[model samples]
Target: MHVESALRTQPRAAEGERVETAERVDAVERAGLARSVEHTMAATSTVLQDFLDGRVRAAAARSDVAARLWADLADGVGGKLMRPRLAVAAYLGIRGGHGDDDSAAIAPVAAAIEVLHTAMLVHDDLLDHDEVRRGRPNVAGATRARLVGRGLKERTLADQVQAAGLLAGDLAIASAFALVASAPADPAALLRVVRLLAEGIETTVVGELLDVTGALSSPRDVDALAVAELKTAAYSGSMPLVVGAVLAGADDAQVARLGAVGSALGVAFQLADDDLGVFGDPAVTGKSVLSDLREGKRTELLRRAYAMADDAGCALLDAHVGRADLDEEGAAAVRRVLVASGALDAVRELTRATGLRARELAVDGVPEPLGGYLVGVVDDLVGRGH
Candidate 1:
């Protein structure tokens, strides 16, 4: 899902050795991909700005709140743009290679994916009571900050801010559909894109429901994997790839193959993220390493750890896993138990196997240049250090 990392240039061949034509071609494609990512970001900004401007003009009396909300949503746009990049990559891959005309044609679709991502993140943050994302204050956090500045008490401030965050998420979801619906593509393709987007959204909602239920009740590995597939895999990975391929008129077989590839890669990405949430460096990941353990997120990692642990280890887990006041010492204890139980290794192996499957699918289904790029994406996402 870290699309930017995948697009980075690898080291050049030894100075004395000549580069092959394939390598040179790959270089060009990589540059095009980087530029396309930038293009998508800019186009997304334009779409958001135009929409916000229209809203402001239509209701001058509410313009202040509207503008503030727009700013909050806009601040959320500068992520890695993974979903949008996936859409563009799929389109270009299916179309043979990058073309300016094609890139222009797919820009709206790419922008819509990013808009939808923003909406999901806003809602996710509200659900998690998380105040930050990508190293910045999230919509809910910013709303709370603004209200606090106006001298509202804590309870009232939290209520108002949460409501505002909900509305912001709703706006983003509505705008995402509008962008895709209005994209200037073939009428049939546009309809397919809309349907795909709706399916992705619905699946994610179901996944969220499962996640909440699992967290409150029993957290099983099977249930966790299901959540990953429906929540992160469908929306973050498969939808963008499938949507892009659909736009390019890919055949059903090809579309299905790419969806499988995307789902595998997405599940791998989430599993790796679960590892990082507990073990990655805070400075590098831009989030607290203890957050997941403190919250007892019931990820596959935790479930595995619990399953593998002895009675004493289980006792330790029970003592501190979900403690709201879980400090560094408590987290360290849980970490020790997790490592001793070999759960981390199990999760890592699962991620590696899943990533390998995704690579296989990409190599078999997608053509060269694009296939290689997607393979690299899976590699970067699965093996990322942070």
Candidate 2:
């Protein structure tokens, strides 16, 4: 029922990694994906999660401290697995295989992406001084809370919490790389996949450093949008898509186009997260509205607001935003400036623009059902609050 040509990559693919080619394509296709996209993502998520759980438990068994630390770290693991889902879609789309087809080859990389995402989030929370994530106590937060309950105070509490977060994040990163390396792919393809991970980490590290040192301090410095792309879009967005397509034996042009599609989506996703940080209800977003304002996160929204605001609006932002003692009243005042200055709406428009761009690119870059599917992915991504 499938065209032989559909199973072959362009001539350029032969110059790179060896394509699975037509002889084996039908066998691979028949081996899995007898279902649909939903089944594919669900199966992929299951595989990676099992890997994460098994590896984590094995490591935790090594010591009491390891067990306690990982228990706290595990609390951060459950999420939408958006990264893994995207990777699975790209793989199936390129390979012309469906859920349950050729899954053994894709599972490790998919799981690796999710593990890496958890690692980045853990480190990001520590850097941001966040005490909660996904409606519960995070690694640093849960540990710090327990310590406080036991009467641990001041520098001692800070010291212990930081150590726990750092170690846990390190373990996840190590495991992610290891998992991907173990994927059953060509040596060349596997190397490329591993390189993507390393590059993502490199880009994210700079992004985090810029954010911590105050990205908005100088007009010459990197803007918040740039920071968001580097920090989030690189690893969380493009890299997942790239890894999936690469394993599926896509050509260079296809790879680049898919990367572009993912970058656009990733940027949109980050911008939406920026909006949620200020405006969304904590009950739904599971994150504090006050943290972004109190931390004075240099989001594009905040930048636009400062640029468009009246002197009075500027004065209010300067006073309450970034104040450690900032309460609900101060936060409300800051939110007012964000609204009155029209920056909130502007950022929302930017998010929409990015999503639209991704939709267009998806049509041009990806194949039939896959392109349509990614367009739907874009729609949901931009519309999300959490």
Candidate 3:
């Protein structure tokens, strides 16, 4: 979910060609595209902070949870503002990069997208039993550390952490919807955006069920690709773009086209993210190689590997893949199986294929700037190793 990379990634002529074919143009319309991204990002950040501040004021009496909630979420808000970037880019691209007013107008919806993303991560981390995200203490991890420091022990500590994370996510979700519903778009369009957000959440919940169950059931039974689509594509991928399109007054056909492209791109992005989780450099990706393996995540690689592995390989995976206390040694062993069974290669191919599909659809399915912009974004994301 590298938001900046997707929007900032330009097709060969993304900037200069639009303004001048032979030379890169620095003034007027070319600069507008860059300004759109900058304006939307800054506005989104301000909205997020204001939202947090309002919450703090409203709950100032018992500031404990609110304080920690603001601290944890606000601190992590800078980068990875992926969904908002997509939403704004899609909106501007659909509008042919002409409406700078739309940038300011779209701020609430974009901010809602960012807040919604944070809520998802908080819940996602909780569900995966992942105490860390982006190489830092997630809410659960931070809560646990605080409790331990305060002399709380065992079950009570865990229970308190759970409560904090769950409530924090709930609060964010409520606010996200509020923002979408209140965005300065046509009332009808605003309603559509809100519905899209709700639907995305519903879709995500279904995918999450499959994902956590993925750890318990046979890996072969889980449709790993479908799971990725459901979990990440709905809210994280297409919803933002669709929301933007709706706000921009795109027609049904165009909205549908963008949605499909978003879906393909979202799935591709998740696949890349999963790959990074397992194999990327933590220093570069801010993710760990061990967490996904330890979670026994039924990633496409794991599913494909299970199908492709021999008995010995299966036995090796069964031993170390899901253990809570799994260490570097166990992770290495799983990686060995992934590589040996060609699951790594297979997943990588699928990632590229998915990204390519999105680009193909975008080329003729949408307008020029959007089509070209998404093409470049997908290319960069697909090729990005970290």
Global CA lDDT computed for model 2: 0.81
For TM-score, the strongest prediction is 3
Give me the displacement of residue 276 in model 1, in angstroms.
0.3
Which sections of candidate 2 miss by over 4 Å?
1-35, 149-153, 215-222
Query: How many clashes does each candidate structure show, in the order listed?
Result: 0, 6, 0
Which ten-residue region of model 3 has the weakest summed lDDT? 21-30
CA lDDT of 212 in candidate 3? 83
Model 3: per-residue Cα lDDT at residue 11: 65
Per-residue CA lDDT of model 1 for 211-283, tens digit only, reads 8777776443446888899889999999999999999899999899989999999999999999999899877
- Could you tell me the lDDT of residue 53 within candidate 1? 63
lDDT of candidate model 1 versus the reference? 0.83
Tens digit of lDDT per residue, candidate 2, span 1-386? 25656556545577454445643553444334334555766666777667766766886779767877877876688688889878888888888865355677788788888888989989998887776888788899988877887776698999998998899899889888888887878889889888988998999998888788773483224388888888888887788888899988899988898899989999999899889888887788776788888777888888888888899998888888788888998888988998999988888999999999999999877875667778878989889864
Greater TM-score among 1 and 3 belongs to 3
Q: Rank the candidates by TM-score, best first.
A: 3, 1, 2
Q: Residue 233 in model 1: shift from native, Å?
A: 0.5
Measured against the true structure, the TM-scores of the candidates, in listed sequence, are: 0.87, 0.86, 0.88
